[model samples]
Target: MKILLVEDEIEMKDSILQYLEMEKYLVEYASDFNLAMQKIHLYEYDCILIDIMIPHGTGLDLIQEIKKIRPKTGIIIISAKNSLDDKIDGLNLGADDYLPKPFYLPELNARIKALMRRNNYEGTSSIVFNEIEIIPEERKVLIHNTLVNLTTKEYDLLEYFLVNKDRVIQKNALVEHLWGDNADQFDNFDFIYNHVKNLRKKLLELQCNDYIKSIYGIGYSFKTIL
Candidate 1:
């Protein structure tokens, strides 16, 4: 899932980013309020982690903006301040959950997963499309009851396709989801072609239907298997 972390503390931001990346989450960060707003306006995220004590503006304001732009996006407030009013106000403003500072990374991850399951995954732990099944919590993929071994990127690609089944996904969107803000560092999307080709080969080898389709001059679409 794509995550936007709005935090100012250097150490705390680094810690959270590292941990989430290791957990195979596509994470991006904004150190201050302006950068956070820029990112919020530019992209959509599955979940957003907002630190209440940010520079330039309050995290609550950012949450409000996010709600206005993407109403269904999951939101979590991570603040050092344990003020009751703050938590209440944030929750009242469409925030899904609140986490106080100095918490474990695993707990934060758990909350993200819980929020995603509730909001994005339709409250289900697994996503199934015909014979293909994905357990996001376990980061496992199964085809016809057989486990499919995949690299982290491959798994993420498949998950993206399954999540947006029957929709055409632009190459730029795929790059941004996988690489976050750093997607511009690459010259071309050739790497994406490689990943898609390999993923297709593996699934076809398993006798799975071809759900990933290229749109000629455009991007690709993930169709439902008949």
Candidate 2:
């Protein structure tokens, strides 16, 4: 999943980035409130981790703004401040969870997973669509009870398609969702075409139905009969 981390401490930011990346999440970070605002406005994220004590603006303000712009996005407050009022204020401002500093990385990871489950997957550990089953935590995809090996990018692409099934997803949206800030480095969406083609080929090889359909001039859709 894609994550946006808004933090100021260099050591803490680096540590969280490294840990989340190791866990196979696409994470982009901002050191202060302004940069965080820019990121939130420009790209979409599955979840956002914000620190209360940020430069120029507070995390509470960020939460309020996020609720206005991206209300469906999952949010968690991570700060050194552990006051009851701080926690209350954050929750009142629509923060879903709070993690006080000096917290364990595993705990943080668990919180993110739980939040994503609640927000996107209806709190389920596995996503099931027809013959395809995906266990997000394990990054495993099974087709008709048979394991389907997929590259990291291929797996990510499949998950994205599943999440937005039955909806037309633009190629630019795919690039932004997968590549984040680095998406600007690509001049065209040929890379997206290549990835989707590979993923489609893999699923077809497993005798799975072709759910992905190209939309001519627009993009593609993961069409489901139901």
Candidate 3:
């Protein structure tokens, strides 16, 4: 899943980014409110972790703007302010959940998973697309009751496709979802092609039909319904 962390504290932000990345989430960050605003307006995230205290504006205000832009995106208020009123106000403003400061990364990850399950995956721990079964919590994939070994990137790529099944996902968007906001650091999308090829080969070896479709110069689509 894609996550945007809006935090001003350098150490906390870095720690969250590192932990989430290791957990196979595409994470991006904005240290200040202005940067946060720019990012929220530009891209959509599966979940957003916002710190109420930041430069320029209160993270509380950003929640409303984010809701207006992407109502389906999950919101979590992660702030040092643990006052009852603050929590109440945040939830009242349509935030999905709240995490206080000095929290463990694993707990935060758990929260994100819960939120994604609630909002995107219909509160399920597993995603089943035809004969393919994916248990996100366990990071396991099985086809025809047989496990299919996939590299980390390959698994993430497949998850992305399943989440956005049947939609034409642009190459750059796919890169961004996998590599986070810094995908521009790469000059080309050849890495994506290679990963897709490997994933297809692995699935085909398991007697799975080809579900990924190339969209000419645009990108590819996961034709799950076919």
lDDT top scorer: 2
lDDT of 3 by residue, 1-226 (tens): 8899999999998899899989878888998989999998877788999999989998889998898988888999999999999899889988999999889889999999999888767899998878898988888899998999999889988988998999999999888877777787999886788899999999999999899998988899999766
Candidate 1: stretches off by over 4 Å: none
- As for model 2, its CA RMSD to the true structure in angstroms is 1.0
List candidate 2 segments past 4 Å from native.
none
* Candidate 1 residue lDDT tens string, 1-226: 8999999999999999999989888899899899999998898888999999999999999989999998988999999999999999999999999999889999999999999888757899999888899999999999998999998889989998988888889888898888888888989886788999999999988888999999776678998754
- Runs of candidate 3 with Cα error greater than 4 angstroms are none
Backbone clashes, candidate 1: 0
Better of 1 and 3 by TM-score: 1
**Candidate 2 lDDT tens digits, 1-226:** 9999999999999999999999999999998989999989888899999999999999999999999999989999999999999999999999999999999999999999999888778999989999999999999999998999999989998999999999999998999888889999988886788899999999999999999999987788999972
Clashing residue pairs, backbone N/CA/C < 3 A, model 3: none
TM per model?
Answer: 0.94, 0.98, 0.93
The TM-score, computed over Cα atoms with residue i paired to residue i, of candidate 1 is 0.94
Better of 1 and 2 by lDDT: 2
